[model samples]
Target: MLKRCGRRYIVGAIRTYAKDIRFGPEARGLLLKGVDIMANAVSATLGPRGRNVLIEQLMISPRITKDGITVANNVQLEDRRCNMGAQLLRQTTSNTNNEVGDGTTTATILAKGMASQGLEVIRQGQVNVHALREGMLEASRVVCEELQSMSQIVETIGEVEAVATIALNGDKRLSDMIGDAILKLGEGGVFLLKESKCLNDELKVQEGVTLPEGFVSPLFANQGNGNRVEYSNVLLLATLANIERLDEILPALELAKSKEQPLLIIANDISADVVKALVMNQLRNCLRVCAVKAPSHGSEQRDQMQDLALAMGANLLENATGLSAIEAEDLGVVSEVIVDSSSTHLLHPRIHNEDQVHARVQHIRALMEEAITDEEVDKLNERMGRLFGYLATIYVGGANELEVSEKKDRLNDALHAVHGAISDGIVPGGGTAYLRCIPALESLAPSETPEHQIGRDIVRNSLRLPCYTIARNAGVNPDEVIRQVLEGSGNFGYDAAAGQFCDLKERGIVDPTGALRSAMSEAAGIASLLATTEVLITEERIRPKVPRNQVTKDLAGLIGM
Candidate 1:
């Protein structure tokens, strides 16, 4: 009987070992599923026309916008399995965005494709664990090569337009306008260009623009003690000196009244008598006032002051003797006085012809407006919907040019937008560009080789965690979700190929937390793979050996029982 029992025990142990080994396949499948899901999600937003799907799901309170980073950052996933994958994906996306100003979607797609293809080789029982690693390295090399081949040098404004059009998916008008704006701005000046129909209007120049010495109220009327006032159609003129006081108000008021124009008082300070006289004249309602402090003598201070003046109101003036003097000279009735310390001499306001720069600016503004339109934006969405594509630019310039820095910054911002779009859209990359490379990794997969198989199993198991999480959050059966994702028959929430989401429907309707979940899963997978073999072995061996006996153990010890 004892012999029989020993045989049974041995059989049971063998069965348990078999069960453990079987788990390897399941784990591997899960990892592949996660890689596919995330890859597809990122690839959905590759081109310039890529659409941001998550923005649509946002509540009415938080305005929705089709931006990938926002969507990816916002996704929420219920399952812990996908957390690492999602996190790694997001990190990769973010890194790509920060580095190139574009191509985040492509990078994400590449990563997922690489991981999936690597796993396939292991599954095929061809390659060993090292072979899979080698394959991934080669895959990365290919992706980089492809990216380099696609990247074009943008040397002229025309080249910029071409690139923009490509990124924007052939929006000619939109591309033209953006190009025009860059060309019009050139390198040296700031121009206030109006935006029309999403396009920028012609640059409006403020001649002899002056800056205040220090920050002060936007409403100050001519060195006066007058009460605070408001007005419509008030012209603002900025100056550097403190001149006319209460004595200047009446004369200035008389001249202003003669023109039957509403009055605005602007100065550093005013005399009390002037304030009373202006009130008695019933000119208070006709007036709006702003007082700006003078700026220090320096280019930086001047620039800061000029920006402030522009923010207040248009029509900036330099130096003026006093309100009384301005009135006597009939100097435009002091529509609005702005004080600044940077001006060397007084300036007379002059009218600008919008027609001069109007065509150029207006054209650009129109393009931007058109690009953002429903139809145009949709086209962009379509182009971006493709998998495993990249729009990249390498900006090469001398390190010292401020213009280069500025251009680089703008480019980076645009690139960041592309990344954000991809994260939100959640599409796959290039139909698994690493497909051809799988055979190399298959040679690394082991059949009876336990150690090799263990590595493959670890990677496979890690990938599945994301799939489980995605399934749970989407409220789908985890097993069914896993199978469908792996088979490429269904999507988690958004369509990678369409760059649209049935769940979101509108722009800015994605769950950023879901993206985070995917990223976290990827991270965990990496951590597991990189951890020391000894650590993994310890984790596998450690087991619960004791049962609850808290009360009895303490009591028995106290009684020396």
Candidate 2:
């Protein structure tokens, strides 16, 4: 019995801890292979003349895109080790995306180049891997500082369009619309992109607030062809009360139904069964109603709802009793309401209580003046924006669904780039900003060790990869372009589209300094990790069981039966 138990224990241990392990050069080489494969695919779409990748999708038509993150997300490898490496690279791209919302392509190439070069150095021996990683990390910080100092503020609408145009892949119309929207909305503005039936894109700017909380249920979006629940001349009921049963708000619903007016309910909470009943009633045309949970919580929720109530000239219901006692005259009127799953927009036709609105604005400004922390200041600014902000929606038009998807992807990237620029500023573009940092990076620091120097060298050398890839994609000799850019000083870089050396900033070609900084820093950190890694462990792939009949047929075929 002891022997049997021992055997069972051994089997269970094996099943529990089964993993495929790799070590040393073999592991690093396989990882580099993965980095190469993914980087190569994404690098093709690096410049103005860059090529689009056609991606095969399941349950939908294939998508053709020039977006780097989209390409990286679709990569899957047959080899587990390679897939692990690919996934690591994907992390780099994702980090860059989350940090800056653009420059995923640049980040991918930088990570691949840094990892590959670092591996080659490791193969050459003599350097401490830990020291090398430390050096790279330090070098990344220095480069970011240099880029920050080199960045110029985007102070003009033309400059904004220039940055947008590059990110949008030379779409002037889209860039123009985005620039106009940015200019009109100013700082802390909110805008949305929507698909348009027309072949030409359209833009609409309005004065309103876009709340983070959207419709409580999608069924409330029945009025529109898309997911948006839109209403004209709607009545709004704002309350801090939680609706536990349908009877809680049945009177208000009946009032709206009798008045033949659309009603929007902003409450603290509504039970699932209550939401279901509301949805069903709307679907059956029993009532024209939509429900959304009020934005924020506690005191914040009260303040926002009060601000909204003030704007709508409605009574602020503080408890369940007020909600139950709601009347037709108690509901506030709004010119329009647009809601999606993620956000809600309320537009007032005109300020109902103009003096009260002004007083509220002044009170918020006073609070801002007395604010002690950055968070407080930000919250006040957001409240101010909500009260008097411009909400713009860009209706993206395309020839078909595929074109629309691709265009929307590009537009989102551009929008993010614009935001990055606004927050941090803009720097030289087309890899020029990275290439210019090599000299400073290569300069030896006073306390740098030999291994640190080698590591720093690896990063500085790898920095040239973006420019080289862009030139190669543009069908130019990358070496000559690099040499020329190095010889020229101060914002001089190769224009892959124009195939000549010119002033990048003068040509209106630039990248968000924040995006480039994020790309370089994230790439350096990940590549250093990959370089120091000596062990790779992954789940052992299990083979599916074959049926006895299929196995027998295979054996008979082997015997020529």
Candidate 3:
């Protein structure tokens, strides 16, 4: 199947095949090699104080950032192994981002570490694949629990401040501003700022209170133009009136008049007679009037109403019946009436004071808190849980801050697969699910098993490429770094039977430096778990190619072609 594809295609097919197969050591090694290639590229930019860089290649130039998502999306790689490895790293990053809205780098490193150590156990014949997987699962659980337990409470203003502080540590002012905005808005209203606009100084508050330009009507106008009317001693209505009932309208108006309030009937619609009666009553009692329309009916109308309400006021009443009249009565005002057509009956509005407003705020806050808490608990209890998925990470430590920063961007691109998985909840065992599959690989290995040997070789060889790259950059011999990595694992590269490095390619051996080791570990784990997983690969339908005519004198000037 691979041979007919030609050399480049075959290599590509093999690269994909290695990621898709889940048996023995050779497959594991290939997978690991891919992972390491990607991880090492990112490890350099892991710290909080990391800076940014500019990456200029022949075809593209990207202003590099330490942000995991940014980096993961930008880096370029040609080798099939590198590409696959990078993909796994990306998946881990995505997983982290989706789950926590942060922590892609952390997950990437964790997966890398598990894969690296799991392979060693396989080589040592101390544990089978199943045991290794169990260990990984246990480790993941421990890690996730630790994270969740760390400052889970975000109740007080101080706690919220602390969250903003950590999230925007580099720019204390930005954090301070967010904290301040939250404080100013109190608990009821959310402080919504686009991520990009968070730091912009031109932001304006346009909702809630706006000073009247002149002698403006107390009634807040609905978006529609024709549905205008006036009121005095305004009974503010907050509901959709979609029903047709003289019975409903009459009672609500009577209640308003009992309070001596002039009703500003805000509703979806009112009968012509109902409107004329309200106008007549206002003139008879010397009452002023104002009326605003409610949103239309149906899903779109509901959505618009919600949006309008949210933008205009912090508190909203769900039932829009006779509440307007009730509120006017409380305020010791004259008749105020409100009507809603959708309701079975009309309701009197209740005027809310500062105390009522504060209560409403607290209610909203409690609701949000309850929701978050419930979600957190549910996530913890799931079979996969928050911690069981990809926790692989790559930590890049470097003396040159800029170089390290640049590598972070590259590494993130490589880990896109993991990142995405974390964002969108994963299927039990899918692509990038290998982070939880290390134990399965270990189980397949045995004492003196060729599979085990292949896994080790793959891991070791994978690390060599990055080690050499780093060594060369640092003005050291690539071979020296490669040897150091092997020695650190209690292994020697000088095997007479393998004929040194001459037959490494033939024997499926490669350099196993730290980067390669980590990458391979992650890739192998992902492959083991997700290899049999099938995806509904959607092929974009090809559009008919349009032929371009050669530019004539007339066209050349117009197009500047």
Candidate 4:
């Protein structure tokens, strides 16, 4: 019998590997070494005092950053197997950063320590993987309860700023901007990112809405008189038809031209001939119209187009095999259309039917009240925002391209962090949140058997490494700082920025509970996976290579030598 991933094997893929495989100690050792290598690379940038890593680009200027994701992403190891192993662990950090924001460094460090420590118990081969897994999970359950018990409510704008500040590694300017933006946007309001208008270290947020779709040609840009064209009563025509043929789109164009209305066509594609005609007609000042490809492709994208159409009282057409009738009642209305090179903006369009909009809103709210998990709530939030309040944009600026790029990444982290804090309660940042769970973790020690004890102890103590790194990176001794904090009140921890120990929450250094929990779960899960992995069969590592003599002959033949 042979093991198969699903029902079949991929073509040109390794099937049964008797060779090119590492097992037991050798495989486990490689995994641990990979974790260690990556951990050491990122440990330097763990706290507010954490320094940036400078990486030189081949054809451009160098990049310097303290962002853990940036460092992890830039790494490429010589050993492919080791690199793959490190990447698997890095996925834990990636998800944490993507989902809740922040804690990439903490997540990586926790994973390294757990996998390193858990390997010892796993090597004994006395405790089953299931048992170790159970012990870890139970410890997590306890830690989570402790986190809830210690969480601080985030109800004000200041608290939101605090969370964003900590996540951005203490960027006060960025933090203040994020806090103000979130407060101004209020509930269900969107926060979008845009490039800076000027090369100055300034952060600005404007009230605006954008769709992923944009206009096809700049020629139709409503730059009437070199001023922003306030194009109104624009029809949003969504269809799957290729309106390239003159007759198909001619009716719609003629109808809009007659009514003195602008037509904003959204379709899979329009004929080049049609686009030329539209541009020429607009140039002659006889018509105002632009044809842009519908955002997204395929069925899902078409459905989104239909949804937008329905919301705007526009007619949606499908399977239009020939020229179709264009009706005035099928047209949609927008308050204004602002076109830029990047995207087209449609501002505050009315639904026209207030009673119906209110009823639909109440129904969606009911469904949302029953929704759980981030994905469900996110869907509803987006739906509500699209129907009612529109999304806003924040333009992050800096003195240079590099600075703006880095600031954008930092602002993204801050944005998500602020959102997470608003949705969930806050916990003390700077590692104090994890350390606070130790007493609870240890409380389970008395009931633990020897096998469970080893796993449980690792989980308990590994939590301190994050704080240790935070303190050490701050130019202080972690051991002394930890000792002092543990001796003092539960809330107190080492603040490397201030170069002293203090209460983390009181000083406005806090994290969202959701981010912390997501990171912890991801770290523990990956560590368990690494510890339990006993064999490594790298198909890529065993691929046959072409001989140099053959390659040389091929090159010589090409040159007619």
Candidate 5:
């Protein structure tokens, strides 16, 4: 029987074939080559002295950036096998960026060093590759512990500036702006970056709560005013119920219309018919109303809705039954609400339970302290921001669009780095923290197996690559710099930008401990995976046809041309 498959046909086709495959050293070598290329490109943007990379865009002007993840993301190899290897390294940087926000370059450089060394050890046939990979991971864990132990809390704005400065590659003005925002907001504050219309950077702050949710339909927005909706003295119905039927909240809509007030419904969902009914009432001027899908999902949705309802002085409706029984006393009120396609903002309004809101904020802060994963911590921070905190935005300005884009990227990096420093504390910068942990890694399992020992050695040596690269980029001898750093104690390291040796903190050079640790752990993880890779499989590359004349002699004669 013939069957349709995608855009092609199949006649009892069940078999599959490998397009390309390589085994042993050949596969590993090509992958390593790709890793080398990507790492080399990114490492050039590693430290205070790091150089900017110019990236060509599809239609717009090229981008000039010193961001490591940006450079790593733009690299593509011509060799398929090599590209596969580069992709693996790219994942390492991507993971670091997502988790820590500012360690992609450090992660890439470390992964490259470890993978290259592990491959060399494998080629010698002296140790078990699996055992070596295990040792590398174990060493990585120990180094992470050491880094945590060495971290210093960022108590003052100066410390915050230091972390931001390193992330921004010594842009002190931008770093100071981030520091000021953090200072003004205190802990758990939320601020964002935006492009400025003016050529001078600016900062704006307001009393409001922001949610990553908006109107259910554009029809709900003010007509012909883009996808934006605004209401004054609004009534809010917060619920987890999925509103498929209009009658579920018709009583509340009537109450809103009678009171001559705009109504906003925040719920898990709103079906098409329900949205249509709401939009019709709004269009006919019978009622000013809008429905918004609740922020987040699952338990998070429940928690956020509850918090939002509390802040808006309303009680949360849990199900369709609760929605159907909605009363004036059950709904909440806010001074004003402004919503767009992407987000909703509740301006300074009413607080039904001020003490409870304070209690919830404390609870979230406590949860943040115990949150094990970055995802958990981030969610908790968002909750804190929505519950009760300052909201600020930094408007980045530049001479041109490309310049603004580049500065925005740098500001984003600085912002993340500062937040990381606040949460996880700061460490000696310029890779000093990684090097300081080498002693702990070396001392681990003094009587381990040969393969394990080799694995540990590979990771131990790879940890120094970040500092080495930083010095090399600064036009200094990296080996000498590493030697001097090892000879000194605690937070003592090279200042690549100044080409001097001193305590990193004294030089106002420090890294967010969390980002630095993420860099180490993620790099080691990817390197171990590459170390044990004995087989590589990838799709065959298809080349485009070469251009040629379309008309042959026979065709031309037939056409009488």
Candidate 6:
């Protein structure tokens, strides 16, 4: 029996702990085993013909789906060590999703295969882990270049629609809608998800939707006036909602009236006095400015408002800057605004692109390349996202909640797939993109050089896993697909649906190279990290709180207690 005293481990008549408790080989073996177990668990859910995994829950009904990322996420392990290994492997998959927004399955399979092969080679005692990583790094670089070279442009609407169709399992309706939305928005569009209130069971695409920052007080509620209100030619303000400044907005309100346009006062705040003044103006037929607090607050709120100013060609009222902040040119044109007690909706039907938006994108990219830190890079990415200028919302309509839920998932997948294609072009999907990378890596096989040989073996095997798993999952023999694909010259491979050789591109099966690049980078990163992991350390589970009287006093002999 083992006992612990004050964070120390004791085996016999000792009250101490060993510092270097290394289960080096065992730990590594478990890493490989754990990752392999997870990969195999999801590998069966890889292709079009891949079967659904029935994940049963305690008391609840089981879930059935062929989504690889979903399967990986729901993976469970009874053993503690295996669970830890699975968790570490999961980081790669998670990163793939967050970064590239697709290819979680391929990433998982690659990471596990790399870990397994490298572990086996090192276990033979002929080579070190560094050699494996060096080869993998080179192999990964070549693979990336090959993928980029193989990519076909997503220029036409139909081609882009192919990407979404394949990702959505040939749902042409959703795919077409997504494709058209991307084309209409011109690549800088964000996705806004919402439920539909229409009679028909369908998905509707709205050009743009503004996120309301916060709601106004109930006193300003248009109660019984329905929830939607339309405002035009709004005076957009960025100052705090101060009642004392009620008179400050009079000039802009009057200017809009003279121009024969409705006044839309988008302010940071609407003090009680200002609200009353606007209401009185409406009653007296002077001018009715639909007052709404700007959608967001603080630094983020300010930035968003500023972006709106840029998009709408409106001027932001900066009281801190000067009194001149409320110029006539600063007023913006908003298509409509839906005001309510809970929130406000600002809609811009037309997506007007400023020439500076394109310039800003290029500038942001250059700054990103020169960034010195992770923080800087992230900030630049955020800025780039803002420059996109608009977010397109897909209002999904369903007869019930479950149908809506299912449609939302499919729509999301289609959107991400379409987004990735637009961002980085695309490569042949159904595992062919990953499959094609093997020959490039195979060239590095060093027969006589054991150190390099270990690395080569790890990469070559790992490089094939995605294709292999995909084929195997589709009920086709992996060995046959590998031979056929290797025999062909161009980008052609086994058709998962027919279980025969065909052009994947012709079949409308392809994946985003951006997503592929992200998946590969993450896969390589996780494999390299696992290769260098010398030990797995876990703290012992703490016991329940001890009673003070029952506790072993440290100064027992001195105090005779």
Best by lDDT: 2
Over 4 Å off in model 1, which ranges? 1-28, 48-58, 61-71, 124-152, 187-561
Compare candidates 2 and 5 on TM-score and give the better one: 5
What lDDT does each candidate get? 0.39, 0.85, 0.39, 0.73, 0.84, 0.67
* Tens digit of per-residue lDDT, candidate 6, span 37-117: 888887776766766676755445555656667678877675556677787788888788766667777888888878777
Q: Report the C-alpha lDDT of model 1 over 357-382, residue by residue, as the tens digit.
A: 34433443354344633344323322
TM-scores, each model vs. reference:
0.38, 0.72, 0.46, 0.74, 0.74, 0.78
| CA-RMSD of model 4 | 8.0
At residue 1, what lDDT does model 1 achieve? 100
Of 1 and 2, the candidate ahead on TM-score is 2
Candidates in order: C-alpha RMSD to true structure: 19.0, 9.5, 15.9, 8.0, 8.2, 7.7
Residue-level lDDT tens digits of model 5 in 288-341: 998889988898788888878877788899998887787898888888889888
The sequence of per-residue lDDT tens digits that candidate 4 reaches over residues 1-561 is 245644456533444443457898789888788788888887888788888887667558788777787788777676766876788878878887766767787889988888888888777666677667666767766777788888878888888888888878888887887777677778445555668677644434444345566667778776766433347757656677777676787777777878788877777887778788878988898888877777666865665555566556666677455236767666667767676555666665554455655665677668766675545655555555555546555676767767876777677677777777878789888888898898888766364466566667778878889889988787778898887877766678777788867787888888888878887887888888887888987644443343469887677655434
Per-residue error (Å), model 2, residue 541:
1.9
Q: Considering summed lDDT, which 10 consecutive residues are worst modelled in model 6?
A: 12-21
Better of 2 and 3 by lDDT: 2
Question: Model 4, 322: alpha-carbon shift in Å?
Answer: 12
**Residue-pair clashes per candidate:** 121, 0, 102, 1, 0, 4
lDDT (tens digit, per residue) of candidate 2 on 1-561: 999999999997787679989999999988888888988988998988889999987558889999999899999887889988888999999889867779999999999988998889898876599998998898889899989989999988888898899888888889999988888888555556678998878998867777899999988996567588989888888888998999988888888888788989999999999999999988998888899999999898888888888777788898888878887667888888999999988886333677887798889878966676646755776676666645677888988888988898898899889988988999989898988888787675644478888778878888889999989999989998888888888889987778778999888899999999999999999999999989999888765444569877687655434
Question: Which has the better lDDT: candidate 4, or candidate 6?
Answer: 4
Compared with the true structure, model 5 gives a TM-score of 0.74
Off by over 4 Å in 4: 1-18, 56-58, 122-129, 187-189, 194-197, 201-304, 310-315, 319-333, 336-344, 352-389, 394-401, 538-561
Cα error, candidate 3, residue 274 (Å): 7.3
Which candidate do you rate higher for lDDT, 3 or 5? 5
